[model samples]
Target: MEILKRPMGDYQTNCYIVKIDDKEIIIDPGMGATEWVMANVKNPIAILNTHGHFDHVWSNSELQSQLNIPLYSPKGDIVLMQSSTWMPELPPSTPDIAVDGDKTLDISGIEVKFHHFPGHCPGCSMIEIGDAIFSGDFLFEGSIGRWDFPYSNAESMRESLQKFAKWTIDKPLYPGHGNPTSVRAEQRNVDYWLRIV
Candidate 1:
């Protein structure tokens, strides 16, 4: 398996491309990825989104259209996906597959799992493949996601953090922003946040 990270848009959102054998799956095709993907990827089978924030879904429609692949996103953040009061205009495309809870799916021959961790956004989620996890806005290297947005809930984030702390502590963590980290590292880094009420 090969994982490529491309930073896109003003936020430098991380767009991850997971390639296993001949099949490729894109995670968060943010702005400026259409051209890149067109020139680079091969045999893209599907798109897996962690959430619906603009920075994460900006190029989703274009990429999906161009690649002619299906897009899977959490059904919890449909409001943010449809319209964001703060972000620039975006192309709207309904998610081809909506994940509302923890589930495993097979894209062609690759197995991907989704875990809902609503906090930064109502539909915040993470995708696990092999020993790595694509942690959207839910958890970062040394910080967690912001719960001050419109549909965000602090309590939910805290609960998610606690839940995350209980998971296996040795897998690599690929977050939405910044460089990659690990579950054990994040468990230690996020200790302070978990202490909050």
Candidate 2:
């Protein structure tokens, strides 16, 4: 498996392209670099989002059109994805697949587990594929997501953090922003920042 990270737009959102065999899965294709994505993916199967925040989902429409792939996200975040004010710079696009908690999706031969973890947004989720967890805004390196937005909840965030802490500690987490970190490292020390929120 090959994972490529592209830092996109002003938000510096980490857009990931996960390639296994001849198929690819594009995660969070933010603004700019559509051509770069096209060059890498051959018969892209699905476009996955961790959440529907504007910065994270800005480029979905264009990329989806270009690649001719289905878009997938947690069911609850469709509102955020459609709201013009929330995602002002983004074009109109609805997810073809609205995933539920703990559901497994088979993309070609890769099995991706969707973990519903609502806190950052009502439909926030973490995508677990093999030893990697695409954790969106849920948990970052040495930090956690903020619960100040209208859809965000501090209690939910805390619970999500605690739940994540108890998860198996072997995978490397790829958050929406910042550098990647191990689950064990975040579990041991991320609570310090979560406590202040």
User: Model 1, stretches more than 4 Å misplaced?
Assistant: none
TM-score list, all predictions: 0.96, 0.94
Ten contiguous residues minimizing lDDT sum, candidate 2 = 83-92
Which digits, one per residue and each the tens of the lDDT, describe model 1 over residues 33-56? Answer: 788777768799998899999989
lDDT, candidate 2, 1-197, per-residue tens: 78999888888989999987778889988777576688888779999999888777777888888778899988888888886565565776699998876689987788999988888888898898877899899888877788899889888877777787678657899999999998888888756856676
TM-score of 1: 0.96
lDDT of each: 0.87, 0.84
Write down the RMSD of candidate 1 (Cα, Å).
Answer: 1.2
